[model samples]
Target: MTHLSGGPALPQERRLVTAVPGPKSLELLARKNAAVAAGVGVTLPVFVTRAGGGVLEDVDGNSLIDFGSGIAVASVGNSAEAVVRRATEQLEAFTHTCFMVTPYEGYVEVAERLAELTPGDHPKKSALFNSGAEAVENAVKIARAHTRRTAVVVFDHGYHGRTNLTMALTAKNMPYKQGFGPFAPEVYRVPLAYPFRWKGDAQACAAEAAEAAIDQITKQIGAENVAAVIIEPIAGEGGFIEPAKGFLPRIAEFAKANGIVFVADEIQTGFCRTGQWFACEDEGIVPDLITTAKGIAGGLPLAAVTGRAEIMDAAHSGGLGGTYGGNPVACAAALGSIETMKELDLPARARRIEEIMKPRLAALMDKYDVIGEVRGRGAMIAVELVASGTRDGAKEPDAATAAAVAKACHAAGLVVLTCGTYGNVLRFLPPLVIGEDLLNEGLDIIESAFAGR
Candidate 1:
């Protein structure tokens, strides 16, 4: 089936013509290793020639069922009709006039739409940027400007971004923060309501974790000294950990009471990926500021810091923009992305994905001891792998097994990803437009991998 783009559709099936990194791809990988920096990483080295719907065609004639969605950046498909049309028209009109130098209507329209579509009904404003990290840094800047405080609070196992300050804000050490230190100061981390890992009853962990976090903030870092409390409604790179229910509301309340800006890092969970415009809406938690990217502009680079008008305007007039902050093409793509989302009812599609995925994953838990737990919301689903599935005790994380399963799936022409603080969670993020047949085929590959078939 053609996507709304009505573009040349790639076959939405897993077709393995040869081994995964087929000869052509291996040659490309060799060239890449020589040309690319070692610091940058690649998940699957299969050189993609074209992609559409739910499949990506590698140069070696392999059709892989895409579950990563280019790390959730292509949720409306790689070429949604609206996104292509709007961006093409804008590209033809002008590639770059520098929005700051000669402002365009596209930028203004995107900002206006962000205000209308984001969580709260309060008067909101937005500043666009080139990437998620930029949006996050700007959010912190705006929060500090508004609150007149130095300390910024984040949570454990939360992944924000890769910029210097974001690296300090991130909790992971190996790839994200290792050797990147003497980092930015005044960034503090408290406990997340991580239900699966909590020592106490998972249900009770919500209220307790919130209290513990609040206590730490009050005792260690005075509330008056804090500028913002930033968190992900559903922690993304840190294994899609959905904080226990009621946890977010408490933190938001504490931030509100303390005159601190509450920022929701929705880079991964925004758009319709989590069955809603924003994951913060799940519990009626309205953040003071929200940082968004990933699915914001179909597949283009675009991010935004959207928040209450007063908080956003706190930054100096010239403090917020960059030369390429809101490129006309990217802004137009964002408008199309939002349009596709609304017209296709992609949020409902994400919910339907959850309805199909969770049960299949949970059934696997019964069959595979390594599957410790299946958790997440909507299309952003994951299964945590553990060495032991004891009836009553902590499960040992099995990152090796997770990696092996992912490799096996890759060989079978399915693209999947693994994440977590321990790196033992296998996460799936198929495009919202993926057909049910392809989705089932991808899941079948996963099940077969587990069965060693």
Candidate 2:
């Protein structure tokens, strides 16, 4: 019952003292437009001055319910209690000597924790990094070294990261990989068993998609040339698409049989976001390599590639690591975050979030014609909008409706976010520590948005 999040002390209730992007925020937005990079985007155009528990207090004095949790990075909540305490202590003690240069116990402790926490009981090893993209890129490097192969397989609608190699692995184009072309070679794309969009016979989609993906690899690239099969157990930016049952297992089995490393890119779905320490555990899928980042350090920049010791150690001594990799402060924060997760049993809390959110979103689907489907697990739920919501499952995406609804939610002091390759999925990644009342209020705002209230 001890589910606490530490941040600026503020009321948890929603209070719109002014418009979401009120005078102060508007002033800041004006400055940002002039000073910041054009490519950088703003979701609500509000400047957060404080955040904690379930609410974000903007500079405009509006308390917005935080449904996005800074894209799931603050699952333990912004400035989580332990995170602040440990990071403060570490910061005051010593910032960095770089594990590769001077080494530190904090780094080793974080690595050991990763080995203990990540899926599988096998002897595991981990290499820490600064971002999810870095973790993913290194995972590929390790896979290639271990398998001594070049081809890497990823699925359609799978978003790995924004870096060159990762961008190549990512399937979306517009915002992620449009002009950044001439991407890394040797990465192959395959079909995902996305249930909602699967052509026919939903129950058989998993077997069919697995076979299709396997056939493509066997014929297109040849299994011997493949280094790894990387995937998100639940697709993130490309919509929170949870692949059909049996598909993941089949792919993992195929990779194991062919000596292809199976990597679960659990960047967005890890650390209790999906009711488990890692989403792969939902299906009992133990990857050869798993990349984690977003929630690892409770909002700090920390990422890791953890896997079987043999695969993780395949690279030479100096092959892996960065100047900022496993910095003492981030390591300390990660330890604190992990401690908080276990102490609070955030995985169970995430399940509680699912229990509270999914039904409400499903109810919204029932009430709105624009809602195509309500999908996702634990705190990572989403509502896929279509031209017409139907139990039969309409496929036409209604991006306009999604955008309008999200805009309305923001105006009403609810911090909502949208995703999907088609840009028609409204995603919700509430901090696990969010109170039930705030959760309900956020849901009420969603209902109002759809009702045009």
Candidate 3:
């Protein structure tokens, strides 16, 4: 009844002594509202005191089952022994010699490991960064440098980042994109092979989407002008929509044939979150460049743009580095995170998570008319909620119901997250080290929330 994946488990169960956002948390919230910026948002305002091994304890002494994994940044658990040890060692020695100014081994080692673990054996190289958006922007820069083209292509319902260029790349409107206009130019949005929303079967959907995308690139953007075709191997933040089978391969082939760089924005799906070292491996689709962050360094801020040596080196001598890019501490944590992943075979653990969650979610679909579909891969699972009306047509998105379910779970002692362009998808991104008891308890809370709603 114990898990040793993370350092010293903290009684992996839900315990609610006070209300969800007890007195201490409310006190912090009031201070935060006065001190913090209005644009910043929080999913659950419970001030966390400590966390590890599938449980997060708030100041109010409420231990909630962590189903979000800090938005999938804690794949190896929050305080994996290896991560803590390595990071602590690095912190003690030196925290900030910034690799750009004073080069260090940890950053070089991280790049080396990225080359070894990422998809493809094409003499890959990497440049580390401080965040996912920075990695993504650098990827586009590298692609543009290599291809000497100005146009970048992205897909619908995709969430890239919050930077100016990334905001242009993203497809959402309200929170991420709205009021942030005049985005980077020459960025074209294409159709994604969303199986559930497609008009036909899976294969047909893939064919249609691929054809449409190719047509758009050919006529509108012109392949000759396109520097890169970037996409999420398994789209994240866009409802965990797995690209229909055959969709990614066709896009890769088209990019290759047209001398365009194919970039996989695996910030959310990389680092064994999707049952593979990278989600691109699921269909044998090797991207020309891959952007990664999130789970790269346990819970630290680290990211990388890894790709073929030629493409990565295309950037000028000093073109691709930030002052804080690849800090020694973050790099050390990343090395430890990768070591822990390999030692524990976290990819297999993610597969086991899929095995446990998919069936339960599928069963819910049969019982709940609001659950239009359950989709995703490995531990990155989600259920799309819809307003039920007819059986043969499109289901109306029920954002209100999704909000209620998430709020209800929060009221109880479970941490869950909702996503999707329509905001009707409940995504479950549990830490790979979560125990069965806690996992089941989180599911029970979700089921009860739906029932009560």
RMSD of each: 1.1, 1.4, 1.0
Per-residue lDDT tens digits for candidate 3, residues 1-453, read 465476865887789999998999999999999999989999999999888889999999999989999999999988998999999999999999777787999999999999999988889999999889999999999999999999999999998999999999998887998887888998999999999888777669988999999999899988999999999987788899998899999999999999999999999999999999999999998899999999999999999999999999999999999999999999999999999999999899999989888888888888888898988988999999998753236778888999999999999989999999999899999998888888888888999999899
- Per-residue lDDT tens digits of candidate 1, residues 275-385? 998999999988899999999999999999999999999999888899899889999999999999999899999999999999999999988778888999889999998
Off by over 4 Å in 1: 1-5
State which candidate, 2 or 3, has the greater lDDT. 2
| Model 2 per-residue lDDT at 295 | 96
> How well does model 1 score by local distance difference test?
0.92
Pairs clashing in candidate 2?
369-389
lDDT (0 to 1) per candidate: 0.92, 0.92, 0.91
Error of 2 at 194 (Å): 0.6
Error in Å for residue 288 of model 1: 0.8
Q: Give the TM-score of candidate 2.
A: 0.98
Each model's TM-score?
0.98, 0.98, 0.99
* Candidate 2 local distance difference test against the native: 0.92
